[model samples]
Target: MSNYSTTTLVMTRVFNVSREKVFDAWLNPKMMKKWLFTLEGTNKVAQNDPQVGGTWEIVDHRDGKDYRAIGEYLEIDPPKKLVLTFKMPQFSDTVDTITVQLKELEQGCEMTFTQDIIVPHEETWTEADIEKALGEYHDGSEHGWNLMFMGLKELVETGQISYKG
Candidate 1:
């Protein structure tokens, strides 16, 4: 066994738009800043390169603080799947991988989003400890992603960026 255990955050959302549009928004600079990891009125600097091995960074400036998210494209299958490394240096040095999968539906598209949360597998870490941490992460992360998804859904369907986040 490795020295780490993975806790995956799996969530799905449906959008009233094409998967291509949803996928494009992830790469588009202007569209990204409107939603990706941001608060309703917070400003962010987004730098993204969508090609495989390319890196991305989004720094959110809120309440006189800069919260940064850095990642690299590990795999990209446009309109269908994307895999990237997600890291918030200020929070942790642990680099996690996030995978997004999209499938076309009659109404629109469904996005299956997931993030791999790696926990140290030290002998001292009891099962209870891991569960407790996961509980906290699940609530915070799920809430944040829901807000972002709302923003994305609105942006793509209405051609307007409302900071639902």
Candidate 2:
């Protein structure tokens, strides 16, 4: 197997919601539609099968284009930990894995989100080029996840959330 460089993007958030509720948001189609990562789009397709090996897919319809996020569950421990693959076929063929770990707090819970970003080096690309590309991906991903986290916070806190909000 070829060894490629890997970088992790880690983010943590304290949600004022129970662990199960926060964890369920990652699996439920309705909740996922409201808070999962997406570009600027009002229409979304969220199909999730919350099981050890089941796959989940989300498609965002925006500006006459569909952006799909597809993945398979690698591990699932209710209200505690979840591991899954995440890939956007519209962009790159590289597959990445994400882990969501939730710890119950006195009031609510803290979620630690981790994603492994494997840098794909093209034959003609230099080391600097690879590093630059990785930076862009990391920054863009962090921004998108932050937006989705905001929506999630709203959904769990207020029982309603929207992409536009």
Candidate 3:
């Protein structure tokens, strides 16, 4: 087994909304569930209170398989910033830090989502393994972030929650 250290993934989106509106979505649990899971086959997902030290869990099914993600909230800020702990089941027990930053732009708000983690120094993931993991991650994150920003825009413009099923 070869050692594995830090792995980081960064994604950015420009949403036609204000920074305040965009930040509120991450601080609210009900708003988060709307766009957090964008996979094609995901089922029900539930999130508890979204505050510092809060816990959350999600159950997703795809291709006749079930997977769960359980984690805790590490930091919370209103309408500006957020940080959370992420975990994946039946895989490496890696600890991840996710940060969402909102920047004001002439057109709208620019949001950046970054996920960083450090695996065991002695662990190794083959090229195929890395590719598979990243594929799933990209699918989930892109969909999740897009949906989240959508919900944020709706809430700010419509004054109602339209993302809920």
Instruction: Note each model's CA RMSD in angstroms.
Output: 2.3, 2.0, 4.8
Candidate number with the higher TM-score (1 or 2)? 2
Candidate numbers sorted by TM-score from highest down: 2, 1, 3
TM-score of each candidate? 0.89, 0.92, 0.66
lDDT of 3 by residue, 1-165 (tens): 245455676878777778887786665555555445423235467566677999877666766766677778888776667788777766768767888888889977888888875455423677667666666665665666566556556665565555344
Segments in model 3 whose C-alpha atoms lie over 4 Å from true places: 1-3, 38-41, 119-165
Most lDDT-accurate candidate: 2
Which candidate leads in TM-score? 2
Candidate 1 local lDDT, 1-165, one digit each (tens): 366667789999899989999999888888888888864357568888889999998888877899999999999999899999998999777788999999999989999999987665557788888787777776777888887888888889998775443
Identify the runs in model 2 with alpha carbons over 4 angstroms from their true place. 1-3, 38-41, 162-165
lDDT for model 3: 0.67
Model 2 CA RMSD to the hidden true structure, in angstroms: 2.0
Give me the runs in candidate 1 sitting further than 4 Å from their true place.
Answer: 1-4, 39-41, 120-125
Clashing pairs in 2: none
